[model samples]
Target chain A: MSATIHFTIDGVEVTGKAGQTILQAASEAGIYIPRLCAHKDLTPHGSCRVCTVMVNGRPQAACTQPVSDGAIVENETAEIKELRRNLVEMLFVEGNHYCMFCEKSGNCELQALAYRLGIQAPRYPYFFPQRALDATHPDIFIDHNRCILCGRCVRASKELDGKNVFQFIGRGAHKRVGFNAPDGLGHTDAAVSDRFVSICPVGAILKKRVGYAIPVGQRLFDKRPIGSEIEARRAKGK
Target chain B: MSTKPKVATTSLAGCFGCHMSLLDIDDRILKLIELVDFNKSPINDIKKFTDRCLVGIIEGGCSNEENVHVLQDFRKHCDVIIALGDCATMGGLPAMRNHVPLKECLEEAYLKGPTVYNPGGKVPGDAELPLILDKVYPCQEVVKVDLFLPGCPPPADTIWQALVALLNNKPLELPYELIKYD
Candidate 1:
């Protein structure tokens, strides 16, 4: 039998099975910790730092850090929120995220998080960096303009689809996602049905010829906040 | 001799679509008119500032000398400046050229584009034209922006709520539906 761990997040008691990370525990307990790179199924990459939470008075990546019995977790404090906001803002300026015309505007997790965080505009200057677009694939395309380097595609392609189709190249501001081929994504064994194709949190990876099929008002995250679903879990638990 | 607070507005590298959305407040404009007076706006065709404005509504980023001059002028004359729409907040569609060299852009537009048929095969460099900047800059980057309302045009309701809150001296906490980036 798996042991259950008990922890308090923001003074609310929560329980989780042993070997679960703080994020997984908090999520099951209906506590929403803002995150960008940590998907439910994929292993935590901890690149975005949007899910940084205070564990026993020290900061740690909740998605990567394991939960401990009687551990004190602080997720929604003012200091942590401000830090998360800065991280999100930097992500905005680092890339040329033209959200206004983007196909993933309403449904994008990054864009929705910005709204949830009350980011009317980024505090930093827009970098307006020059990025590339790879459209060699017949069914899929990669627009580097909107990528946040969350590493979702890299992890999903490797772990879920069991394919080495996506990988990261470069360093620092020059870093970008690269496909597994000398020529392009088309040359790689990447298929439209691959998990990597639909796992991107932004418009970085998208299927061709299916843009803007959903209208603005009817789209996901249009009327509600991004973590509303997770937060909704609170009511169900009670 | 108007007693209401005066407001001014302009579009730099923008389409004036934000201004149209402002008017999309529909009949709430009657409420707006009762609260504030138009000082210098394309709406009233008041070409130049006649009074010190309580608020300056600026749309679009600074893409050229004229845009910079107008924005600096606004900073000097207005008490509060609101950067409205994606262009003013974060260099919208016009900023797509930020990555490309200016020479290439001019060449493509005037000399080498598919639709271009320049008889002289020359880029226009008239002295009357406003000098283009190296890159587009958001309104806040150039000057102090008191507030930012983002979106393609910020939806008329969002603009109305923001303006109303500002005029009434209330804290502007936008609702979920009113604060979309697109």
Candidate 2:
């Protein structure tokens, strides 16, 4: 068997077993690549486009792209930073994201990502899409406006709970989440205990009746950026 | 082209963010427009059409009389009526104030509070606005809904995948990563 392959990240070489995504190698070597869509427990989706890197002079999503021997990856670059800023701008314009008043204001992934990327104002015209809030369920409140569509909750429904209750509908900009049957969440097959709510990455899908329950300073991931949290978790092998 | 479905969308009561989010599919909007006939969205003008569409999406909550009528019309016209966004599915942010009484809201917003034309007149018995329901409710509370897409609004890619699944008659399956809110 051949030995592990070594790759260079930000001019520092890192070695890892074959078939690891660039994010894995970067995290292993204590290099931080910002990401919004990549989760340790769920399958990686390059939807947010925040974890992009310059690999051998090409822009690629570190979460989805795998590493190979002798490959050189640039985790930080001016062009990559600009691209991330644009991606964050698109996400901001694509929905009615008013983070200032949101309960998840300081703890939000989108907000954190914006801070990391230094986004001052949404450059694009706001889509100002009209979204809804679902509080019929006794345990969860779904806020459609803030959703970035990372699809973590959808995956949790399918994988952990084995209930195909939540789903996406329509195409393109007209797309949105929906239940399998004609009935709303109350009438659908999903239960309150389903893991979908816990896995949601934004305030869009929330735990019903639990807003502000966690004190301002006590919320997890509120103080530290996701990059640091990921590094810490990796350090602990979690 | 003949086999593709015709889809229409509408919103009521709550903000129109869901419809706008749908339009946020960006370049994919052109691709979707190519695949279906978008007949009666707020963004488009399709007059004198009723009950002939394949898919009908109604965003926002049914808080007023007009909302009720619109939902009824969608139910009558489309083969499937999807309650898109949280408001459509469960009475969103507007419903947050559901704990308070409607008269109290009116008094604060219109009569007792700030006034452009302090309609010093007594609260009209027959305001054009529909009477508020006792408790805020989702679209399915008033009419039949074919599907419910949760999220504050579901992610764009998830929405795309769902639509593709519907178009292809395949089971809609989103990766677990799409569902997390944290």
Candidate 3:
């Protein structure tokens, strides 16, 4: 017999099996925590900090922090919302995110989260850093301008596909995603069918010849706001 | 003089797609006419502002001295300035040029490449031409934008709703469908 863990998120009692993280349990319980780096198929990485929740009055990443009996989790409070907004805004200004022309505009998780957080415009000054595009690969391309360095592609490439093609280079502002080969993506053994291809949360990693295929006003986030599906599932659970 | 609220609009270093989208409001423009008066706008073909405007709607980013001058003029003569498209909000497509040096861009366009018919074509240095800025800048970076309506071109219904709300002195109510970044 498996042990069960009980927790309260925003005062709502939720239950989960033992050895589940707060994010996993909350998600199965129909609660939504905004996240960027954590995906269902891959192991949890608490790099983005967008899913930081108060666990027993201390801040911890919900994705990495394991749930325990009688733990009080605060996911949606004013302080957390404002912190998330600032983090989101910083991500915007840090990248050359020209969302208007991006192929991932409506479908991008970052843009959807910005809308979900009510970010009309970034409060910080735009860096407008000069970044390069890698069109060397025939099937796929990488635009460094839009990358947030959440390490999704690196993790997916290494763990899921077992290709180990993507890795992080440098540190801080100079840090960026790099391919295994020195000549760029063309020389790398990455395939279009790799799991990393679809795991990107933004327009940084894109497949060729599919730009604007779905058309505007009809993408995933266009039909419904982010977290609405989970919230809908929560409503249905009652 | 008519007591209707006066509004003006302009497009800087942008495609006039936003203005076209404004026309996309269909017959709702008639309701807009009843609500506000067009002052200096391409719709009215008014060359310049002759009177103070209650609202100034600007589309596109500033890429040259003339765009800056026009934006400043609007700021001088208008009470509220609205950055009315993605270009005006974040430099948009025109900002793609920010990666390359302006001199290289000008040389490629005028002196080199396949498009130039004249072999000795010189860069246009006419005294009458507006001097280009080193890089394109969003409207907010250049001026104090009172409001921003972001999209490649914000949908016409979104424009209509914002216009109506501004004219009625109410907070603009943006529904999910109307608030798209692209």
Candidate 4:
């Protein structure tokens, strides 16, 4: 009942489950792949493009690519690092992100990934997309500008709460999250107890009243990069 | 009154946070009051008049019959209507119940096994309770909205800048920091 697939990653031969993705296999084998939108509980949304790896001489998102027998995978190529850097730069310009003021500063996955890739400054012109704030609920907030369109909040709303409250509207740069109804937070029946706010990997959706309460030194994942943090958590069996 | 456009604000089904955000402008509300004629608001006297108003701001979603009627009335009276909160823009939090069937929601909230006075009584079929829309809709679905100022209620500075843009007839632009989700 066991099926295995062999592939070469960074010139090293590795074996994984037949249905495993390259990223999944790489992670199990202690290979670091930079990603923002990929989470353990949620489905993969390849919006960030930071996990792209060269497969048989072509670059593709490692999170979506399945590991095949005898396939050649390169995770540490200069071209891939450059591509990841460019992807991170695009993400920075597509939204408004002031890391100094952000509550997620030290613990942010995007910020950690950027530091890992050594992005000094974004080359693209900032789009400064017009986004709305939804502080209607007393506990949480939805800031459209910090959103990278990763659909984590949307998925959280649907999967955890059983409510498809948030959805993407429009196309391209005009794309933004919308409610299932026009009613404000007080009027709609959304429960305040849902964990969607905590699950959001980025600052797009946030806990309203809890910001700055933990101070700078004590926040979780504050002292290390996300990759290392993941490694640490794994070591602890978390 | 001055020749400037008269603006009215009201809340329907939402928490009054959006209105609070408008007032949170600190002393800036004084400046805004000087620019536009404040006709009706939660902080001011509630009066009904036939005078044509230039802008009407409604914060909240239409969850019941009265909420719908109020939105329609605002549409009839004002030249522009702005949905100012997440509930107004995209059913913010309340629309989360759209996933459940209306009957199931009623059972969970009222009926179930609870021994309330109406435990044995049939659910009221009266027309007074507003018919719940099958799906939560943004303000644009119920009526034409001139502009959308999305945010939990948006920051006070963003609101001030938007008002200034409206007064000067300039395109409203939000800074990247202001629009970000965090």
Best by TM-score: 1
Which prediction has the highest DockQ against the true structure? 1
Deviating ranges (above 4 Å) for candidate 4: A184-188, A230-238, B1-182
Collision count for each candidate, in order: 0, 57, 0, 25
Candidate 1 - chain A - TM: 0.98
Backbone clash pairs in model 4 (N, Cα, C under 3 Å; residues 3+ apart or in different chains), count: 25
Can you write out model 2's per-residue Cα lDDT over B1-182, one digit (the tens) per residue?
Answer: 36568788888766877777787788998888778887677878675454388888888877777788888988888888877776776566776556567778767766776653565656655676566665555687788787766555655775677677776778766553333222
Among the numbered candidates, top lDDT falls to 1
Per-residue CA lDDT of model 1 for B1-182, tens digit only, reads 88888899999999999999999999999989999999888899998888899899999999999999999999998999999999999999999999999999999999989999889988989999999999999999999999999989899999888888888899998888998778
The residue ranges of model 1 lying beyond 4 angstroms of the native Cα positions read none
Q: Ten residues in a row with the worst lDDT in model 4 chain A?
A: A120-129
Q: DockQ: which is higher, 1 or 4?
A: 1
Where is model 2 more than 4 Å wrong at Cα? A1-3, A232-238, B1-182
Q: Per-residue lDDT tens digits of candidate 2, residues A122-178?
A: 445444555777766667677888888787777788878888878888778877888
Alpha-carbon deviation at A193 in model 4, angstroms: 3.3
Residue A142 lDDT (model 3): 96
- Write model 3 residue lDDT over B17-78, tens digit each, in one string: 99999999999988889988899999999989988999999999999999999999999999
Error of 3 at A72 (Å): 2.9
Docking class of 4: incorrect
